[model samples]
Target: MRKLGLGLAAAALCAAVPVMAQETAPAFDAEAATQAYMATLSGAARAKSDAYFEGGYWLILWGAVVSIVTNLIFLRLGWSARLSAWAGRRTQRPFLRSLLWAAPYILIISLMTLPWSWYQEYYREHQYGLSNQSFGAWFSEGTMGLAISIVVMSLLIGGLLALVRRYRENWWGIGAAATLVFVAILLMVAPVSIAPLFNKYSPMEAGPLREQILSMARANTVPADNVYVVDQSRQTTRISANVSGLGPTIRISLNDNLLNQGTPAEVRAVMGHELGHYVLNHSFSLLLGFGVIILLAYLSVAKLVPVLLRKWGGRWGVTEVTDPAAVPAAFIVLAVYFMLATPFTNSLTRMHEQEADVFGLAAARAPDGFAKVAMKLSTYRKIEPSTWEEIIFFDHPSGHTRVSTAMKWKAENIGAADIE
Candidate 1:
């Protein structure tokens, strides 16, 4: 009887062991965890980030002003008319004439805006310690970008002018459709062709990390066989990755900065987020949404341009909307329209980013890793901002928002086997 009782007691204790372990586990406090992550970026680091990001708000306004002013200058001085007249002299075909006009117009505007571009892209980036290139290197890249722009813009202008001349009444709708198609083509081609012109891409070295990423891609149904790494460190220290292109052109690429600075888990977190963009079809969705917006912009331009041309066409030497010389005036209208649409566009992108964040949390199951990457990004992005500020200015969730989201996920997923 004594031995039987002892054995029974032992069994009872064993049964209670698992329950006790469960009861003893501490509850995960999401808000506390988020606050702890926020605390990581404090003092000068926080201030510097805030300053850099806030300065960008001013830059946005100033950039719009500069663009509008530059276009206006072209109109006011009749430079656009002169270019159009020169192109007409060179070619009888309206399409070819439009292309000729666009090439020089682009070049001249680029030159006109070079001082501001230097300040905005080069000087400002260096001032914030975000750039790694010297002035010569920066200018070299700028020249490449300019050449690409001239070619692309010239073709677009030619096509737009042809549409305008052919369909004066409904040109806006047709032009909008053509622009969207052109944008889609650019998206498809840029990942393979244009991106390589800026950075060298090579297969990620054979290793467990590469294998792990490939496995993740497979699990997510991402059609990728290999990972590519870009030499982005030569340009900037920003850690970035992308799953870009459409259909056959799709490429999964991470910059060397990410490889050098991130832990395996952090890399996975970032890649998972990028993969979410692909899996969710964000590229197509974004293009579609922007297509609607572009269509609206075209409608507005269509209505307004004719009225303005009738009033000022004589002075500007622009006879009608179909005139290539009217391009700057059209651009002026577009610049204003886009400037006003900034908040809507930002919100659209921010919502997609938020959705990607949620997907990343689920896929990576590395909330802490995600939080840490958010902290790193705070080096350039303001970690915390006023609610309205975020809504108005941010195109991605603020760092605080990202970290809090990660912590919230962690809280719900406490003790999960795969969570780290």
Candidate 2:
């Protein structure tokens, strides 16, 4: 979602794709292997994980519906019109007007969605033994997130409005470039500026693991001097590590969950996968991929909004894309687009993840480690989703795919003296 245009609306999920290699692979029994992994979970854990992941499928459907419906309601109630007129009356400056208009618009939408957010992020998490946060702490973070969203959306909207006013006939091209630049800047600043809002990041304690992580970063040309540990146990038990930022801001960070819950081999495997993201330049590739998606979304809006307005513009008191009041209706279109594009976008992410798996195997030389970590991930993710579900819903490899890849790697290189 951080990479997606709507910023917070998109769900960050995971999936799998098969990997190809020169070595003849072992014919691992995927179904039996998946069954073995599922057997590892307790009856309660299995039910809960199944319920949580499966419930997520429904959440996706409902989230899109809610987003479109919410925006439509705002337009129908004339809230967008009233807010736009108020901002117009108060500000003569274009940027200031856009900022003024965006503040309330974003706040209204956030407030409207608070109930769902609470249920999804807070209540459900606690119910599942995943959350370590108190309600107050969760609320505080949510508030901070909302504030940041307001500032970001305001700036982005101001720029977009200026572009639209300046190049009404062909703003899509210019708008796409600007959108790319904005996202680039956001990624650059995120590690240093934005990430600290919710969690404290301290240099990881001096130890072999830190040294190992730094070495991986060095080998990968990641430009990171230290491994930072984010205090994520304060919120959830999902284990993770990431190579975030780019260029001068490049940094490697791992969540506390990974340190506490993962074995040393699992740690290396996960770190390898994270490092693979940076080493393989998946971030920029993903940015470029999502950028294209965003471009198409913007172009679709540009092409369709005029026609839509012709049909219902008078009813909502909206004239065109230039009008600040048109934001809600435009949002409805974008949200629908986001929903429709999920499978395509998700496939792109899954492919990148599979490549990372291949790279992780080579980099960490910990095939068993990778396999165990993949099973561990099954604590939250459905390890054996149907093929179509995996294609449509996941952004990272499923456990069966990952474990099989690791098994194949082991089969090919079982007696290698040195993986390092």
Every model's TM-score: 0.93, 0.90
The lDDT values for all models are: 0.88, 0.82
- Candidate 1 residue-wise lDDT, 1-420, digit = tens: 443454556557778565545444446789988999899899998999999999988887888888889998898889888988898999899999999999989999999999999998899899888999999999999999999999999999899889888988588898999999999999999988899999999988888988888888889998665368999999997998877787777777899999999999999898889888988999899999999999999898888888878888889888878889998888888888888888888999999999999999988888998999999999999989999899889999999999999999998887688897
| Model 2 CA deviation exceeding 4 Å by range | 1-38, 224-226
Model 1 CA deviation exceeding 4 Å by range: 1-26
Question: RMSD per prediction, one decimal?
Answer: 5.2, 10.8
lDDT for model 2: 0.82
Collision pairs in model 1: none
How far residue 391's Cα lies from its native spot in candidate 2, in Å, is 0.8
The digit string of per-residue lDDT tens for model 2 on 236-326 reads 8898877778767877788999899887778888888888887788879999998899889889888877887888889888886788888
